[model samples]
Target chain A: MSSIKPLVAVLCAGVLGLQGCASERSETALDQAAASFQAVKDDSNVLRSAPRDVIRAGESLARAERLSSYVGSGADVRHYAYLSQRYSEIAREHSNLVLNQERLAKLELERQRLQLALREAKLVSVQQQGKWLEAQIVSLATTQSDRGLVMTLGDVLFDTGQAELKNSASRTVLKLVQFLQLNPRRVVRIEGYTDSTGTPEDNLTLSRDRAQAVADMLVDLGVDEKRIQVEGYGDQYPIEANASERGRAQNRRVEIVFSDEKGHLGAPR
Target chain B: MALLALAGCATDPAPHEQMRLSEQALEQAKAVGATDEVAELKLAEDKLARARSNMASESYRDARLRAEQAELDARLAEARVLTLKSQEQLSLLQSRVNRLRKQLGEQQ
Candidate 1:
């Protein structure tokens, strides 16, 4: 009977000790997990975009609280609390990811919009400049061809039998220079033609000399020599009959052709 | 007496292997930027420090348990870092795709 009494005392002490240990088990981890879950729940983005994650986090927090409320299971409480904390973190990260994705999409759209606007602005500027250049060369008989802008200088600009340009042609040449300056990307080709009055060889030499003279003048006016191409067709491409004086006058001329923005001239068609 | 003490020393439960493993895990986690990205990494580091202190005080059993816990926490930190990094990479790729779609739409 005395031995039974000591065994009962020992059982009571063990029970009390278990109670004390359970009471002393820290609730800090569970409390922190609960707070983290609450913060995620309160965030509007998380609520709107991460409803499942928030729900899971809430469930995990509940599980952690249950584990902590139990007696003699401190390790279980800590394990569940860690899981709950991770779930809350995942909820927040998911919400942030969605928000950041949206922001990235918006930024990309804005970039594309700006790029399009810039392209359009550049195109409009080119069109307006073309129109202005066209107006400036009205007296020079400018025409748009597949080869690009063509400005023709009549025989009146040069001496009757010589290759020198007349002094009065300075105004037109200056205007051409201004157009070239405004559109610096464009290149020019100078082609000289003559009437069929002389031998083909003589006509070729004269035509070639006249084209070279014009190219030199352009180069002297600050145009890059590499950007100018000079060629003489002689009597090969006369626009009018060489039998009449008026036709011959029309045939003797110099043509200045402007290339495209990339300095590409279309082949003669 | 000395022989008995040597026998007791041989049975020391400080878990040197577990402590080394935990240290290695923590080093790997830190190398991957887990300390900055994962809150659990700091917790693991604290536990590891406690484990070392306990080993110094000759509390071998507690040191072994804490080392094991610390190793688990460090591994968790490594996993979380990978998850976050993958999420970031996915978002970046999605953004790039969005830009490509915009460009194709414009071209059409």
Candidate 2:
């Protein structure tokens, strides 16, 4: 009987050690869950954006605490604790998403407001430059042709054999943008022409690139891209003979053909 | 003794509903582009597989706990992916706004 008593005591000690280990694990999990809950519970943003999740965290933590007092309930306690921590994390993340979305909306509005201000400032500067420039653009550059109302951008706006429009071109491009904005229903086809100097293929590519560059600038200045059509004639439709430098310069030009106010465009050549 | 008897009688019902919920949560996370590369998604997937096995073996209590954990893990993964995407969008807009501001400054 004495031997049996010692053996039983040893068995009891082993069982108690296992229980203590399990409880220790459960205790750590419970502490972690409590910390997570404490961090998010008082956060106003989390409360506002994820109130239900925060409530669930609190409830799960409470359940875990309750289960920790029961014998052999360590698994249940840990499970609830893990769930509680996850809920806290989810709540925090949800709040962050909501705050970011709110900021995005505000930023988008600011961008629109800034865009409008910039447009107005540009128009003011163009007006300050002179009303006569507008008259010159209408009378000198624009003409009524069979294709439609055409406005020519002379070769001086670009360097020799280059597709990039010079900084000097901004004024003209801005004026074009303003015209399009004012006549919203009218679309424009920007046709590029080059002198008969380069290979026909190179001329074709350069002319297309120049037209695309102008179209890109118009888009950057807030013109709707759908209203712009680009075509490259590649020495096919020269305004003057390409034999002399002066004549070649005249031939290397971009012409803007405007659609009628009803948005009717001439067929592509 | 009575408490032990009550506990024995209170065998947990099979967590079919919880398993379904966890599966739905996992699908939702995946739908939002949460791949196995996401640690939370991997953890959720592992736990959910174990939970399925537990369910098949009629270990309802274990299955319920695992499914519950998996559901939250998947939800957290989804929330993390969404938050990350929003952060990316925020930076993109910030750069665009800065560019606009610079252009406006240049114009002025």
Candidate 3:
């Protein structure tokens, strides 16, 4: 039995030597696995963004190391080696995916911020435009009425008891034309009124002629002809008591009404 | 023992079909820009390379396994691309809602 024990020891040593040779034969796959593991561990992005995948890759690499130490270079060793490499690749991919997500979020945030700025700028522009329009209307001494805005020209606009416009009134017509040119979107209506100093038929005819003359003046000033309407109110709708000469003068006037931006002139009140 | 040997000797008749399917899946992933967009797609491409090499060496079992894995990875890449695109769409909708809210606040 003592002699047999020496024989068994020699056989055990021989088997161990064979195992060593097997491990040596598997060195290529084992080295590749080690390199992949090291590469993943060294990648700072992988460490920062893919902690879970890194841990999994490390686990697979440990398994591969254990498989490589086994008694034979076989399919199991190669399989574990492949798994280790694949897990390392997965870790890298996960890190890249995280980076992509961060970039997308940053870009989206920038877009939203830019959109907010654009909207704010548009709002400011609209408000400034509204203010400028309001200032222009005030400069024209126009009053807001049921039919948009109204500007009144007293009887001094015309020759006494005649439908013709006086030369002095040309300045007022020019100013009106400048205002209308600045706001081409607005439509205008001219209404002529007369005092109760003549026969009703004659007053009506004079009023109608005066309204048409004013409209023709606007058209001559480059305002669109279709944008102007003419009306006559003879001995009607007096704003002041016509018992005195001053009241009569106010009664015989021409009123120019401007429509809104949409050219909507509300029903005359 | 003889029956097991016979089973081992039997060849897989559909190896070519399996290889073609994996190649088609990889092509589809590439066509969708997955290789640059999704990092996992590179892994799938590597697996496909391995599968082709195994096929050339007549290692049918290894080739089949690698091919299937490659196909699975390619599909995973496709799914990831879809997920990222959906996230982008969600962000766009969120921005639109935010803009509308801002406009409403300004009107008030």
Candidate 4:
């Protein structure tokens, strides 16, 4: 009886040792896996920058661990069968992920190409279409150049201190809309500027309000909201300095920048 | 004689058993090549596996050394993973700083 008691104790101790070792090893393995995942999350900048291999390996390891959940027991036919199925499934999953990554990369490249083309076209149009405005509005740089629109706020638009579009200013706005509508493909950007006569804070506020008003007016005239973005620089960045009357007159102006596609970026609401 | 032979073969487990367990643990080394440390551990595990199986069938007393080597390799791999994780965290901090800078510039 005493011999049997010792044997039982030894067996129990052996089993416990095995369990401890397995658990410790598993703990270390899990910690490593977690660290790897954390690295991928931190490093991946874009949608597909994370390592695909880590994701695939982690999935397979999880599946394998699930299969061996009933460890130390006798061989389980069902467990083995499940494991085999899981292996095949993991293979398919890995391939699918690779395919998805490739597809996404191709799409991004295509988008970049289109964006480059759009930018080039904008540069050309900016150079060619708005040139006439410099001569017609105020002869700042080119009295007769074929590039870029130049709208003088002092001359044809609102009064020196007002944000309201004047009666004739309405005609100019209408003409601008007509130009956009006729082009039907140019996205317009409205930039508002002001003279240094007011406080910087006040100028900033006024410039923003003026830009918003112009944008709002465009929207009312059937321009898509998505295609338009408004930025107002009060007196910080003036094409012409604020030292002279003529320069201030030149400064108080609005410039329209169009998007590559003239239609609304989002649903026209 | 048969009983004695069976006892010799089946009695107390060999050090090779410990090595086998370690080898099995190595199977956790995922089959990935991601620059991540888990992959490095797995790769190291495969190398350690070569040493392990050799020790398993080895006639000498080197199995003990082989098992220890595998453990060391696993530890190294885990360390690599930790380093990668720390690097990743640093990169995230950099990104946050960039975002804050951009916001400040826009405000101005």
Report the candidate with higher DockQ, 2 versus 4.
2
Tens-digit lDDT track of model 4 for A192-256: 88889989988888877777778888889987786567777888668788899998888887665
- Candidate 2, residues A1-269, lDDT tens digits: the string is 46654554455346666544466677789999999999999899999999999999999999889877665666677888999999999999999999999999999998888888888777666444445444645774655677877888899999988999999999889888877776678899998999999899999989999999999999999999999999998888777888999999999999888897799989878
* TM-score of candidate 4 versus the correct structure, residues matched by position: 0.30
Per residue, candidate 2 scores C-alpha lDDT tens digits across B1-108 of 224423742477899999999999999999999999999999999999999999888888778879999999999999999999999999998888888888788778
In angstroms, how far off is A76's CA in candidate 1?
Answer: 1.5
- Which candidate leads in TM-score? 2
Lowest lDDT 10-mer window, candidate 4 chain A? A73-82
- Can you write out model 3's per-residue Cα lDDT over A35-65, one digit (the tens) per residue? 9889989999889976775776677667667
TM-scores for candidates 1 onward, in order: 0.40, 0.60, 0.39, 0.30
Local distance difference test, candidate 2: 0.87
Clashing pairs in 3: none
Where does model 1 exceed 4 Å of error? Answer: A1-25, A125-150, A153-241, A244-269, B1-108
The alpha-carbon RMSD over the true interface for every model, in angstroms, is 11.0, 3.3, 8.3, 11.9
The TM-score of predicted model 1 comes to 0.40
Q: Which consecutive 10 residues in model 1 chain A have the weakest lDDT in total?
A: A17-26
DockQ result, candidate 2: 0.27
- List per-candidate RMSD values in Å: 14.5, 17.4, 14.5, 19.5
Return the lDDT, model 2, position A159. 95
Model 3 stretches astray by more than 4 angstroms: A1-56, A71-79, A125-269, B1-28, B34-58, B64-108
lDDT by residue for model 4 (B1-108), tens: 223322333433357566765565454433222233455365446656665665557622334434544543453354344344444544565565556555444433
